[model samples]
Target: MRIFLGWTLFPVWSGWAVTGPKEVTAKQGSPLAVSCSYKPGYELYPKYWCRPGFLRFCFTYIAQTNGSEVTVTQGRVSIRDNHTSRSFMVTFSGVTTEDADWYSCGVKRRLWFNPQHSMEVMVSPGKAGARRWWRQWQRQHSRVCLCLCRLPGRGERSHHRAGIPGGVSLGELHVPARR
Candidate 1:
């Protein structure tokens, strides 16, 4: 299993406040769950999951409901909003490479959609060959430390550090390849 953990900070001007990991990494054909916590003011607002469209502001909504809990089997996605907890969760079952994409957790308003948080879901092939290649690569570059940052609006940027103690090395990271 491969896991990618990072923080995705959102600017306060986004309207709604949400907190969750910046990215999620999972193996193909695996089950994965991600949760987003929202501000108390959005408790009664409908929550939704959506995929990014070609246009910057366009979104393809997967499923949404005003209820506290809703599930969609056709999409193999399930969502739950806990009013008492002030948070919502989305779960994906039997995820495939095709399922990898940028998704947003949003709150529906009267006239607009407020995206609280966004994430890039990456599904790895999970083949043994890939794992072996990663291991070999790590052994060859043991002294370098790499940090990947996902900047909003801008694309991803990586920073490399050398001879830093207690920093992440090559083998400790896993980035899924595009299919």
Candidate 2:
């Protein structure tokens, strides 16, 4: 399994932050879940999951937790917010190519919205060849793609910059492949 960490720092906003994977790759027809964490101050605010619209600052809400623990489902998409955890989770069941797009997890504010965290969800064809290519690439460039040298008990202390091929940075966190 492949794991991607989306970590970004927004200089424009203070006291507000969103954390999640910067990008997620899911196979078409499979279920995908993306977890987003927000600042504790916004725990009581309504949490929302939305697709970014073409217009700047416009978002189309797919579903929201509406300040409750109940899971809200809209079609194949579902969103649940856990105030205790200061986070929310969005899940898509039977994802399709049409589902591939940019999504945001945000807190609804009185005057504005704090959709600080956004992620690109890519729905791939799930072809065997593509999987093979990814595995081969990971194996051949294991040092660059992912730094296994830092693993516990590896006895190596090299700090490899964490990033993926598309120039997306995963910050300082080392994401290990799922066995």
Candidate 3:
């Protein structure tokens, strides 16, 4: 049961102060991890790894760290903050297809504007090799690629960074379905 919301818990981009990999891939039954770094002054803000729904609303928080360097864990999800390195890490014990989605590494801010790093989490099922449709329009039946884009708001041009990230038109990660 997936929930869809209209509003976002955090906007896609505000200042681009945080940095992280645009995508993270993992195999089923294996662990996955991603790290995000922030500017020095933001060490006191809470850092989170969450799945965002349509309209960028954060639907679930897999893991989130306190405003300090302590580590937080919830079931299979874990998050660690390193204030000295100005970085935080989010990890999952056993990844499944349900974990694949558009996620963000963000800092909770006082104002509405929060610094967020967007990333796509891809979990490949029981297969050693995977194929993806890139830069072309190939119809996929099982699944479709979900990309995150921030539409231009007021004062921002309609063409400003409003397309797919990394400029890659990824269709889907496909593997042979079991009989």
Candidate 4:
């Protein structure tokens, strides 16, 4: 049987657990990914991601990998399981303010406790929010490296390296993380 007391859902069975980052941040209109990992023995079990609203009433399958390494995509979201890593990843193609929600990742087991964990996704506004986030991150971390490179046999060689208060653009992380 399944039990849903409130926001959290607990199943009556084994006591297996899954772990992952409890919170993730993303900028609107950019891509975001959340990963949940399970123990070794559950590697072959199907993995799924969904919003809690589905667990108690709908019993729906948002995005699931039928115990396979292949990725599953539903609309703008996709779920991929990596057996070797014993983890599953869910990605959102274009994040919006409405996309910010509490999501769950689970390893599905028949007649057994399905290990699951909740993740909170926070989406910031547009470019302004991204710049604000970058500035805040810069304040928290003391070290950010900036590097410039040129071809091996080029004309005059120029090298530049910067530490903490270095200069980085929206393209710093190389991922549209700031876009």
Q: Highest TM-score: give the candidate number.
A: 3
Give one digit per residue, the lDDT tens place, for model 4 in 71-161: 9899998999998988888998989999888877887888534667777889988797778888788877645555565545675545555
Candidates' TM-scores?
Answer: 0.59, 0.61, 0.61, 0.60
lDDT computed for candidate 3: 0.72
Stretches of candidate 1 above 4 Å error? 1-12, 54-58, 70-74, 127-179
**Candidate 3's residue-wise lDDT over 1-179, tens digit each?**
12333233224335368889989999977999999999878999989887776656455667877798888999999899899999999989988888888888888877755677888999886453233333233332223334333333534322222233332446433333222
Instruction: Please count the clashing residue pairs in each candidate, in the order shown.
Output: 0, 2, 0, 0
Ranking by TM-score: 3, 2, 4, 1
lDDT of 2 at 95: 87
Assess the local accuracy of residue 114 in candidate 4 as a C-alpha lDDT between 0 and 100. 64
Query: How high is the CA lDDT of each candidate model?
Result: 0.69, 0.72, 0.72, 0.74
